[model samples]
Target chain A: MHADSTTTRKAAALAAFAGLDREPGVAKPDPILVVDNVVRRFGGLTAVDVAHLEIQRGSITALIGPNGAGKTTFFNQLTGFDSADEGSWAFNGKQLKGVPAHRVARTGMVRTFQLTKALSKLTVMENMRLGAQNQRGENFFRALVPGSWRQQEDEITERAEELLERFKLNTKRDDFAGSLSGGQRKLLEMARALMVGPELVMLDEPMAGVNPALTQSLLAHVKDLREEGMTVLFVEHDMDMVRDISDWVVVMAQGAVIAEGPPDTIMSDQRVVDAYLGAHHDAPMSAEEFEEQLQEAEAELEAEIEEKA
Target chain B: MDWNAILITTVKASIGLETVVYALAAIGVNIQFGYAGLLNFGQAAFLGVAAYGMAVTVATFHLPFWLGIAIGLAATVVLAFLLGIPTLRLRADYLAIVTIAAAEIVRLVFRSVKFSSVFGGSDGRQNFSGDFFAMNPYSPGTYGIGPISFNERVTWILTVGWVLIAICCGLVYLLMKSPWGRVLKAIREDEDAVRSLGKNVFSYKMQALVLGGLVGCLGGFLFALGQASVQPDLFSTEFTFYAYTIVILGGAARVFSPVVGAAIFWVLLVFVGNTLSEAVSAGMLPSLFTVNNIGAVRFMLVGLGLMLLLIFRPQGIFGDKREIALDAR
Candidate 1:
């Protein structure tokens, strides 16, 4: 009976994510967020100029690109950290144009920074408590009267403790976030974002400075987020991590989306290769081979110079 | 040379009216700069507006003393709102620039001959504190031990001021331990992080401004009542800087740091000034150090002390250094 029930649950989970693993920008049966003609400009540079994009519900989507490809910039605009010059987008079918960053989080779409802002002066537990929504203790007058929010404060503490344990950070809960290692701070940030109970969590370069030892655990956490019925949109440069966990991938280059597909197809996409490897796509196999070829050319040029002298 | 007299006076100055006044002001600065990480260089304006509010209302407009006090607090709140609306959204330095300029404007307006009819211009106003002194419950006598004694009036003001300080400290302690205070600290460290967690950063900053301004305004009431007068020059930009010094000296972000800092600051000022004056009179020091020069010398010594403290221990006496290592960006 137990085995039958497990198989049934697995079948249901597979059905839910079936069509979402298709080509990116292809309309999902139930998309949690949709973007159209969103553009952002900084001085003379157009940082993000995404024409159209859609994030599938309950699927892990990777936004992969080379550096300066405007991946982070596009995330900022979508999450309301920065405003778009024009165009609009919707999350859960609600328009998000001109919404403030805090309001966007309140509307069940929260984002984590690429640099991992961990409220350095605050304790990890305090940072987690700050993430919980609508605490009575946040009210000025109520804050003075502890009894007014004591019960709710207890609830938030319990929740924060649970999240800390889940992220294996309960040991460091009392320590100041500034004292944490880079990877630990990234974990704290992710755990803090989860405290909001967000439907859509946007991660900006989750593995930027993380060690290889922690990368597997972080990847597992991202996949677990999808299993827990939350949609994730992440910006990453590691193609291995993208292929390992991402259901769909969106490739950006020079402030625009160049290609979108499942990770396997995206790896072979010519535009993505050109954007990443450039015109030297047919370069030598290894560093030693390339160095040998450079030496041969240099020897020929030196011989010509010697003969002229 | 009455060295004993100088020692007694220095001891008295440690807990005197000036100490209480600056301590109260520094507590407000603690909220703005220490906790919220706001750079408010116009804290003296809050005190100034309140003092003038009471002075104009009671002495010039013939209003009741209580009504004057109420109007004074309301005016401080209004000033906080007015200042916060335009500058809170900008960078921290913009608030500092605007606040210093706004404070100067307030002082100039109070000093201007155009407002002499209401503000009394540079000469200032008096007789507004009579009602407050009339309400003093203490008997008419000197109160205290030895040379530290105070008259009934001074005793009454000291009692009320210290009580207010205690209450304000308790309020701050309770608030800082709450979730709201957590958000303020987070904002101080990284506002973008707090905002990303669904906090209204602007609203929190504005609330902090109003709360700190209101607390600072209480210092103005005490000043006006203690002296029975209000002058435009008394609320100069130097007053705010003095408050900042006290906040840092006591340790920023700690509740009782300002109170202790204010006491130490006044004691040091009085001690240095008295010692230098006595030395000058006794011809123990060079003739260049006249009694009149003691004031400047005392301030210079305190300034030097502050610089050294910042270099060696930027967190002050009781503060954790991390609290003041703000990420204003």
Candidate 2:
């Protein structure tokens, strides 16, 4: 029963990309975000320079790369947090170039910070309520008259409460977010983003500082997002998480997309391997074999030294 | 020591004009610094600009008193926008730096000889408050209980000032409890976090600046009317620092804290200055401690008291310790 249920869960997302080739910038069957000629430069260094990329709708896409791969910078450009030097991207058929960060989020694409911004001074519940868009009470004039926004506030509180319960943070609802543990903060941040009712959720290194015991639950939360039909794009360095949760993987190296494929295939892709471990690293060898190779090189060096003498 | 005279003056100072003006100014600081985490070091500039706006319009252009009032408010809002547009997008400290400089510039411009004919240079404008006093509903008689009392003109301004303070406190309370206030507090903690959640952080900061500036401008209007004159030096950087001191003393971000804090601050200064001068006159202290230097001594003693209060309760009189803990960022 467990195996059958797991397969059914995977079937929904995997089936969509079954016929697509494992190639860089291959067209998705139903792309939600399409980027073209995106470039960002700081001084003389180009931080992110992607020619083309497409995010499939309703799939968990893992953007995997080593440090300084410009994954976060690309995320920043896509979400309107940072402007690209030259690029235009469309989200759900709307041109998002030059759009402000808040409007981009209002357009159903919400992002979380890598550092986990939990609004430390606010209670967990207030932090959640802050994520609800188009709040009537948020308007300055309407805010003064409690009658105008009381009902909407109640509804927002109700929704926030439900999300808190689902995230198992109902008990900490009234507690300041600053009091939460690192793992709980990540959960709260994810739960708060859902209050926006976003179509696309971008998480930047959600597991970076999280503890191991909470990793399983965090993984479950990511899967639940897919189950609810929301597209998720996450940046991660943990190979286990990338392989376990991601349906599609995009590898970035030196400010460019080097490989794209399903997680299983991308793990063995030659270029992906080279990007991670360098081109010189071949198949793994036994310890004795490695030692033997080192000694052989040392013996050849000794012979050269003797001939020179 | 003239105990009765000292007691009367000290008690009067607790509810004096200075207290009301600083209370209102500190309330504005509470909104900007206490809630929004905006470092508005130029709060005195808001007061200065409003006073000058009204003074220039009425004294120079011979406009109606009401028009001068309107112009003052309009100028304050414009000043807020001007100061906010460039600095709100930068770090919080930039606003502090710009506001401090802008405040000095406003004072100097009012004090400048180039516009002496318009701004009255060092003399400032007078006779512009005739309409304000004429509108007083109270009859010409002393009104008060015991030592805390005022004549009809003083009573009228006091009534108006206290009513303004009550209204501002009500407005702040209502706004702070709403979703808009929640966003401001969230911005205070982490603006980038609020922005990522779909809030227009810049717009919110600007609105906060304007709202706080308007409230602070009320103090400026009161100062002008009470003195029946607008002086540039009265709205100097020292005025802004006093307002900040009152806000911190009263426990920032709390409604009514500024009012209470301002009362306490003036009371301490008046009480200390009166006692020290009285003592010096009576030859109770040494010859070096003269009445002339008692004003400076009062501040020195009060500064020590403030240092002690901060050490024991850094969060101020009513601030939450948990909030202070979260201020590590």
- Top model by TM-score, which number? 2
Worst 10 residues of 2 chain A by lDDT: A1-10
Residue-by-residue lDDT tens digits, candidate 2, B1-329: 99999999988898889999999999999999988999999999999999889988988899999999899999999999999999999999999999999999999999999999999999999889888989999989899997678999999998999999999999999999999999999999898888888999999999999999999999999999999999889989999999999989889889888999999999989988899998998999998898788889999999998889988998888888888887674
- The number of residue pairs in model 2 that clash at the backbone is 0
Backbone clash count, each prediction separately? 0, 0
Give per-residue lDDT, candidate 2, residue B175.
Answer: 98
Estimate the TM-score of every prediction.
0.92, 0.94
Per-residue lDDT of candidate 1, residues A1-309 (tens digit)? 745654454345345556554343566667799999988889999988888888877778899889999998898888888899999999998999999999999999999999999888889999999999999999999999999988998999999999899889999988888888889999999999999999999999999899999998898788777767788899998889998888778899989888887777787878888999895678646888789889999999999999999
Residue pairs in candidate 1 whose N, alpha carbon or C atoms collide under 3 angstroms: none
The DockQ scores of all candidates, in the order shown, are 0.55, 0.73
Q: Over all chains combined, what TM-score does candidate 1 have?
A: 0.92
- The deviation in Å at residue B234 for candidate 2 is 0.8
Query: Which stretches of model 2 miss by more than 4 angstroms?
Result: A1-9, A282-309
Interface RMSD of each: 1.6, 0.8
- For candidate 2, the TM-score is 0.94
